[model samples]
Target: METRRVIFFLFDQVHLMDLAGAVTVFYESGCCGQPYELRYVSPYPQAGVSCGLSFTNLEPLEAVTITSSDILMLAGMDLSKWNHADDMKWIPWVQAAAATGATVCSVCTAAFALAVAGLLDGRPCTTHWGYTAALQEHFPKAQVLENRLFVQSDNIFTSAGISTGIDLALYLVEQDHGPAFAYKVAKDMVIYIRRDGAATQQSVHLQHRQHINHQVHQVQDYIAHHLPEKITIDDLAALVFSSSRNLTRLFKTVTGITIGQYIKELRQEKALQLLKEGHKLSWVAQSSGISSQGELRLLAKQAGRGRLA
Candidate 1:
């Protein structure tokens, strides 16, 4: 297998986690047999990181020749301390890499750098939620999405905040090596295999789990674990030792979704996953607890329409 090159473009006062998080993901992914040649480049001889540490002996960005298979990541830095005259030198290099069909990505405020390069103009992108307003104000042409973990437009990708960089890197891994390999990498890293870029900042499972109701949580856990089996409201209510009617009311109040809707959403999500693993439609429906392939197909069609809307 030809090794894919991943290069990090570092600058002064760069967020340490934004840079290190992605590096760790890529490194751990390599342990699973994904061949990646990681490199660090900067305009300066050494780059100061936000955590009072520095990356030294970095290759000069101008000296490197980016290729089509290369992934060039721009690390987030302190926007207030940025020097436009000095930093503007890197913009042309970014454009050059993009022109070569290399995948360009930004972590957090690094989207600002891409915007300066005119690469993000008229593209759907996002930055840290705190900076989303500023990003929109500066780049009026860019559609800055709020509360998104990441956004991908063509070969350009942008992610929210510091830790979401790992999510984006794992997403890239999945895009390259399939979901099974990406899941293995995520498992090795002890992190969830995050949803797609279009997903909300928090997943449905995580979003609905912030309550202190242990009994309701028990029912949620049962549903998640027993998706392949036939589950009913009575079964969930029995898990919590409550009447079905009361359980339904409590579940809706806590999760904001009725029990039936939650189950349907879970089944649809599971069906999508099984399909991604190359399973047949009928098998996906069976494994995801959908009654038949026809139901799965209708759900998929509805999902497609939602995306288009």
Candidate 2:
């Protein structure tokens, strides 16, 4: 495993959860075969944080060097005074860091800082739900997304509110490692892996888990990981140790969707993820169990997402 430095950009009166939640995710990944050097650097040497405690033992912002493999995380902060006397220093540093290919990320109100550095311009980014309009009004160039749990446009990532920072951090871990490892991290943290996007855009890993059926959960997990293979109702029934008739009826009752529909949606979700990552259409079809390009397009179109690719 490669060692990656995950640096947190600290400031005075910063939201503690915004910083700590993501820090916990990266720090805990070390136990799971992912080596990460977690560092904290601040514009000031030390300052008071939102949790009524001071953030101490911090290095100055100019002390460390930035690299392409480094991850810079800016947590939520008081944005009203963002432009006050700090212009000549950190903004240019942030711009240069992004130019150097470091992945720039923000949680909640820190989107304003990224916007000030002009990183979010023409990129789809999100902030706390209440501040989306203000961000768009102030920085008209940024494509501000309102209802996203988080948005990832290339290397720049932004999330909504404090808790979603953990979601984004888990996502970052997933990108570096893999879904299975990320899921392990989430399981260890005792939190759900609420994958990227809000509402209807939720990842397949989380979307169908609203029910309390263990058998259905197992079936869904199997279907998701085996998207490229053919799965029959008999396979699921045997896996759950039930008759085909009983399993089919119970699956629909528990998940509110039939087994076939669940499999199809899982494949569609895989196809959409592949498409978003710029894979070729044929590969998307094959990897997502869509049979062919024509079938993939037809499924997406029927789902009310025309020209999905």
Give me the candidate number with maximum TM-score: 2
Off by over 4 Å in 2: 80-83, 196-203, 210-217, 227-254, 267-309
Clashing pairs in 1: none
Tens digits of lDDT, candidate 1, 1-309: 788999999988899999989999899988988969999998889889887899899999877999999999999998987878786668788899999999999999999999999999999999999999999998999999998889989999999979889989988897799755775677677776555445643345555654657787678778877888989999889888999999999999988999999888888787776665566666776688888656777766654422211
Cα lDDT tens digits for candidate 2, 57-140: 898878888899999999888775454486656787888888888988999899988998889989999999999999999999
Q: Model 2, residue 216: what's the lDDT?
A: 76
TM-score of each candidate structure, all chains considered together = 0.72, 0.78
**Which regions in candidate 1 have their CA more than 4 angstroms from the true location?**
200-309
Using lDDT as the measure, the top candidate is 1
**In candidate 1, where is summed lDDT lowest over 10 consecutive residues?**
300-309
